[model samples]
Target: MIIVTGATGALNGFTVEHLLQRIAPSDIGVSVRNPDRAQHLADQGVRVRQGSYDDPDALRHSFADAEQVLLVSSSDVTADVITQHRTAIDAAVEAGAQRILYTSALGTSFNSPYPPLAIHAATEQHLAESGVSWTALRNGFYGDLGDLLGPWQATGTIAKPADGPFSWIDRRDAGEAAAAILTNASSLDGPVNLTLPSPVTLTDFATHAAELSGHPVERIAVEDEEWIAGEVANGVPEAAARFTLTMFQATRSGHFAHPDPTLSRLLGRPPRTISDQLREQMVRTE
Candidate 1:
């Protein structure tokens, strides 16, 4: 059986959906915090068990009879993420899983300006020393570029702190690729860069938004401190604002610029482009 954690989330929910298409639902089990939320999956012949990273006994029971366990990384910024990951990794090993797969981010490094990258790097290191087979799906950035761009359509300007090239990928594509990897019996161990084939900068994003919406858009770079202060004054938490600032710092340092063909190869087709996402965003707002 293959066990997947955080099955209710967008990324892993898509993973579970794709897995059902490729394998027997009986061969799949989901370890989620709320079994009630996964009742739909359970009705489809999947084993739904209540589990949390903080609960070792629960995680062990949830991970039982597992050939492989796909561990979704924690998203709680205020919590000790590394500790939570370690607990999950240890539980998977204790449950006698043959292999452990982790959802990590691309450009993960201890020296990164982004704190999340450092956390992922530490988790990868723990996985290497866990005395079990492991694979880290190093996924590219997947989020609304519109959040960073602000209301470019209405304001005619994409304003943010300085940023560099980023290879943003669709979350669904990354989730599908992960499902493919789980169902295959290939020896693809270690970190795999799952990213789009091209990179896009904020300026490029502005141009795409302009062309897609048929509206003029200008890319304006704000100083780091100024952007943070402005966001804080507008009710954004100080910590959250600073956290976003580090992403720009990392991007300018060339952390998120690299693009690889591994994701396209896995999916057997080219992944969706930034323009495609921007077009969808415009349609939704309209």
Candidate 2:
């Protein structure tokens, strides 16, 4: 059996859905914090167990009878993320999982200006010393591009701190690729970059948005501190604004610029491009 953690999240939720299509429902189980929330999956014959990274005993029960376990990266800024991941890793190994898979970012470096990348680097190090075979899916940046693009349609301008190219990928594609890797687990080990074949800068995205909306969108670079203040003024918390500023710092440092063909090879087709993602977002709003 293959057990997946955080099946309630967008990324892992998609992974479980794809896994069901590829394997028997009896072969899949999900370890989520709230089993009631995943009752829908339970109805489909998937074993849903209550598991939290903070609770070692619960995680052990949830991860029981697992050949492979997918450990979804934690997103809680308030919690000790590395400790949480360590707990999960130890639990999975204690539960007798043969191999472990992790969702990691594309440019995960300890020296990265972005703090999250450093956290991922720390977790990867823990995985290596855990005495079990592991695979880290180095997924490209996946989230709402609207936050980066700003209110382009209303303002006719994409304004923010300067940024470099990013090989942005859709979450759906990343999830499907993860399922493919899990089913064919023996072929890949260590870090594997899962990203689109090309990279796009903020200016490039602005151009695509302009063409798709049939409106001219100008790209403007603002000072980092000024941008943070503007976001704070607009009701975004100062700490959150500063965190976003660090992402631009990482981007300009070329942390997210690399693109690889490995994702295409895994999917047997090219993954969705930034333009394709933007077009779909536009359609949803219309």
Candidate 3:
């Protein structure tokens, strides 16, 4: 069986949905913090295991019978995420999983300043040291702006301190890459940098959004304080408001690295273009 952690998340959900197309529903297993919440999977005859990265014992139980397990990284804060991933890696080894596929970011390098790369690099290191057969999908920015990849794109304008070129990728590539690693889980060796090679600037994206959506997108450069004010006005809570601002600020530098389209080669086709995905999502909203 192939086990998928974070099965219900946007990106993870797409990955599992695609996998279901290739594998019998019975052979798929989903891991979530709340199993009852994933009744959709349960009803589909897929096994649902209750677990979290924070709970090693539960993780061991989650991986007990699975030959290949995709360890989706935790979305916790940058400071705490590495430890959480390390704990999960330890359990996967103890459970003797035949292969482990991790969703990681392009690690700390000259390409970008996304701080999470340092953390993801550490997580990838842990997976490598775990001694299990492994593959790391170093995913880049997603296509949609509402998501982690290009929230800037969602508004059709990136409002941040970022002034360089950046790439946007579709989640379909990420899902396909996961399926590839899991399908050939046994033979897979190392990592795939899931990003596009050529990147576009935020201004480049703004012009496209204005042309496509016909929405007047004004790119406003705001200070940290001004940004937080806008987010709070937009419904961000007080306690977490700062952290939320920090996330975008990090991306102003970026956590999701530059586009590296390596995953597309394994997918046997090009990934979705940001504009195509954006148009569909907007139609639903309209």
Candidate 2, superposed: residue stretches over 4 Å from native: none
- lDDT (Cα atoms) of all candidates against the true structure: 0.92, 0.92, 0.72
TM-scores of the candidates are: 0.97, 0.98, 0.81
lDDT of 3: 0.72
Off by over 4 Å in 1: none
- Provide C-alpha RMSD values for all models, in order: 1.0, 1.0, 3.8
lDDT of each residue in 95-124, candidate 3, tens digit only:
878788888765343343445567777877
Give the candidates in order of TM-score, highest first: 2, 1, 3
Counting clashing residue pairs in each candidate, in order, gives 0, 0, 11
Model 3 residue 45 CA deviation in Å: 2.3
What would the per-residue lDDT of candidate 2 be over residues 152-271, giving only the tens digit for each residue? 878999899999887788999999999999998355899999987888888998888888888998999999888988999999999999989998888888888888888998889999
Determine the C-alpha RMSD for candidate 3 after optimal superposition of all C-alphas.
3.8
